[model samples]
Structure formats: structure tokens, C-alpha cells
Target: MRKITAGFFHSVDGVVESPNLWQFDAFDDELGALLGETMSKIDTVLLGRVGFEEWAGYWPNAEADQDFAQFINNMPKYVASRTRSQADLSIWQNSTLIEGDVIEFARELKAREGGEIAVMGGISLARQLFFAGLLEELTLITHPVVAGKGKRMFEATDPVTRLELKRSSTTSKGNVVSVYGLKPE
Candidate 1:
């Protein structure tokens, strides 16, 4: 089965949400490249409801922006939500709401014809996979910034688990790219 790739940008202090969020625009080139590679590997993009709405709003019209105008415009997306009633999505050729059980569904998806299935945001969804030993690898890009407060990353009740750093590198713009795979027991 294909592995699950969790990719997110964070700060030096491990803050995924930074104060100067405008810099995200500049990261589009990097984002596009990364996402391009991701889509080349996996066809499915797992997203939470909020993130789903945010992405759907931006990506469909990314053509207006030079960076992700081409890359983000394409690629199938799936949203994990309980409240969402509509499944019709214009951004992706194959977009749908994750119905029924997600863990088993995710696994079934990875087993489909693809290279990697990416999961973004929906920390609750990620935590579910992590605790169930379903997540395979984590790709984190740490930017050089910090935000004192925002949405919290981890829940208080989550347990500590070990992951092995498989590869790491620093981008020209000083972004830290770290890839961690689940440690073998």
C-alpha cells in the first residue's frame, strides 16, 4: 500500500500558524513544486472541513496567482467532514466528502492506484491515524518565524510516540524540510 504523507509548514518554535502569514504567498513556488510532486505520487488530498473550504476558495482561482496558478488548479481533493451535506466540488475532478469510517477508508484509498495520499490539517484526523498506527510519514517545513498564540497543534491527551527522521534539508529561503517516518518496532 502507498504511504500516507503529512505535509505542513511551521515555525522555528513549532508554530504552524505564524503572525506574518503573508509570507505564505511567497512560498507558492515551493508549495506548487511540493504539491506537484505530491499529486504526481498520490491522487487523493485529504482535508478537514475548514481547510477544505479555505483551499477550495483559493485553488480554483489560483490561475490569477502566478505561482500556484497551474499546479493547485489541478489535483483531486477530499474533505473529511460530518456537517457538510454537499459533495459537489468544482476545483477537483474527483472531490468528495469522507463518509463512514475514515481510518479504514484512508487505508483503502492508499491501497488504490497511487504513490502517496496526503493529509493536511484536520489534526483531529491526523491524531486518529497516528494513534491507530495508520500514518506512515510526516513532512514538515519549518519557516523562520514565530507566533505567540494561535490554534494549538496538539491536544493535551495525545500520547508521545517516537518517529525516525528519514531525511532533512534546508531550503534556500531558510525553510527547514524534515521528513520523519514511523520508527519500526
Candidate 2:
């Protein structure tokens, strides 16, 4: 069985949106290596509708020679959208639309034989998977900045979900990368 990992570039205040506003200064070779290593393990990407549309528009036109761009462009992408049809998803190469119950679909995907399935920066999809108990791991590359106000990674809600910190490290540029495993219910 494969694991579902949610990776995010976050601010010290837990903001996950618009990393470009705060992430540039803390992007070092060490962080690059770590992100590259993580990407190497992912064979499938799970994205929400908004993220799918945004990435599809940008990545295809991006430099194909770049390793990250090539990896993302070629990877099998599953867009979890209630509205997007197969024809709509086919606009992007190797892209598929996931309709109906997302939780069940995610579980089935995890049961398949493959490398890790990654959920990156899709807050809606990530929240659904996290709350559904479908996500196995969460990796946050936390930068040394307070976003003040933005879409936070985790919002306060009902019963809190507990995560066991598996590993943590600080980059040369003061970015903290932490990996956490979901605690068993």
C-alpha cells in the first residue's frame, strides 16, 4: 500500500497560501535538495480543481529542461473535482478527473501499488483527506516569517487531530522542515 503525503511550504504563522511572498529568501540548496528528494518519491499528484487549473496552465509552458518542471509535467495527476469532467481534465497530459466520493477514491489510490501519492498546496483537498483520516504523513517546510493573515494550513475546528513528529530539521537559511505521522485512532 502506498502512503498519502501532504507537503506544504508554510509560514511561521501557519499560512500555506502565497508562499512566493515569504519563501524566496529562505530557499537554499539544502531545502532544494530536501524538496527534490521528496518529489523523487512521488509518482502521483492529487490536486484540487483550482490547483489543477493553475498548474496545468503554468507548468506546460514552463521550461521542460528543469527537473522539477519535467517531473510535475510528466507525473500522473489526479484532480479531485466534482465539476471537472474527463474531457476537461484531458487538457493536461496524464491528467485524470476524480469525481464522486473523494475519500473513497483516495483510499483506493492508497491501496494501489505505486510510489507515494503526494498532495501539495491544495488546501481543500488536503483538508478533506486529513479530516477523513486518509493522509498518512504531513511534511511542512516552515519559513521564518509570519504571514499575519492568509489561508492557514490547519484551522481550528472540532476534535483536534494528533500527529506524531517523525523528524525535523532546520535548513541553512532558517527554514524548518518537519515531517509528522498521523497517530492511529
Candidate 3:
């Protein structure tokens, strides 16, 4: 079975939205290497509606030399959007509109033979998969700064998701890198 993984750029105060606004200054060589390694193993991408719209607008036109352009552009992208039609997804190459339940699609995809599947930039979708027990692992590259206000990854009413820390490390610039495995309930 293929592993479903998601990597989030997090803050000390638990913010997850718009990491580029706060995380650029903190990005270091080690972080670059880590991200490169993660991208290397992922052959499929899973995204939510918002992420699909946002990325589809830019990534396709991104320069070939851009770090992630080639990989993300060419990967098989499965988008979960209740509102988007096949025509909307046709704007980007290799993008497919998920026809039914996202969780069920993920379950079937994981059981299929493939390389790693990475959930890209969809906090809502990632949360759903995480709570539904479809996500096998999560990597958090936590920066030292506290984002004053923004949407967070977890909320009060969310189900308690247990994560077993598989490995952790701190970068020279104070970013905390941690990989966690989902613990079955």
C-alpha cells in the first residue's frame, strides 16, 4: 500500500495558513534539503479545492528551473472539490476531479500500487484525512516565530488524533523538524 503523507509549515502559536508570508526568512539550506527529499519520494498529490485553485493558477506557468515546478507540474494531481467541475480542473494538466467522497478516494488510492502520495496545502482536507485514519504520516516543519493570527491546523472540536513522534530535530536557524506516525485509535 502507498503511504499518504502531508507536510505542514507550522508556527509556534499553531498557525498554518500562508506560511510563505512568515516562513521565507526562516527557510535554510537544511530545510531546502529536507523539502527536496520529501518531494523526491512523492509521485502523487492530493489537494483540496482552495489549494487546487490557488496552485493551478501559478504552478503551471512557473519557470522550469523553479525548485518544485517540474515535479508538481508533472505529478498526478487528485483534487477534492465539491464545487469544481471537470472543466475547472482541465485548466491544469494531469488534474482530475475527484467524483465522490474524498476519504473513500484516498482509501482506494492508498490500497493501489503506487509511490508515496503527498497531501499538498489543503489544511481542511489534510485534517479530514488525518482524523479519518487515512493519513499514515505527517511532517511538521515548525518555525520559531509565533504567527499572531491565522487559521490553525487543529481546532477545539476536532477529534483527538494521536501522533507517535518518529523523529525530531532542530535546524541551525531554530526551525523544528518533526516526523510523526499516526497512532491507530
Ten residues in sequence with the least summed lDDT for candidate 1: 17-26
Best-fitting candidate, scored by lDDT = 3
Model 1 TM: 0.82
- What are the Cα lDDT values of the candidates? 0.68, 0.86, 0.90
Q: What digit string (tens of lDDT, one per residue) describes model 2 on residues 145-166? A: 9888778877777368788999
TM-score of each prediction: 0.82, 0.94, 0.95
Please identify which of the two predictions, 2 or 3, would achieve the higher TM-score against the true structure. Answer: 3
Please tell me which model should have the higher lDDT, number 2 or number 3: 3
- The candidate with the higher TM-score, 1 or 2, is 2
Which candidate gets the maximum TM-score versus the true structure?
Answer: 3
Q: Which sequence of candidate numbers ranks them by TM-score, best first?
A: 3, 2, 1
Window of ten residues with lowest summed lDDT in model 2: 152-161
Show model 3 residue runs off by greater than 4 Å. Answer: none
lDDT of model 2 at position 133: 84
Model 2 ranges off by over 4 Å: none
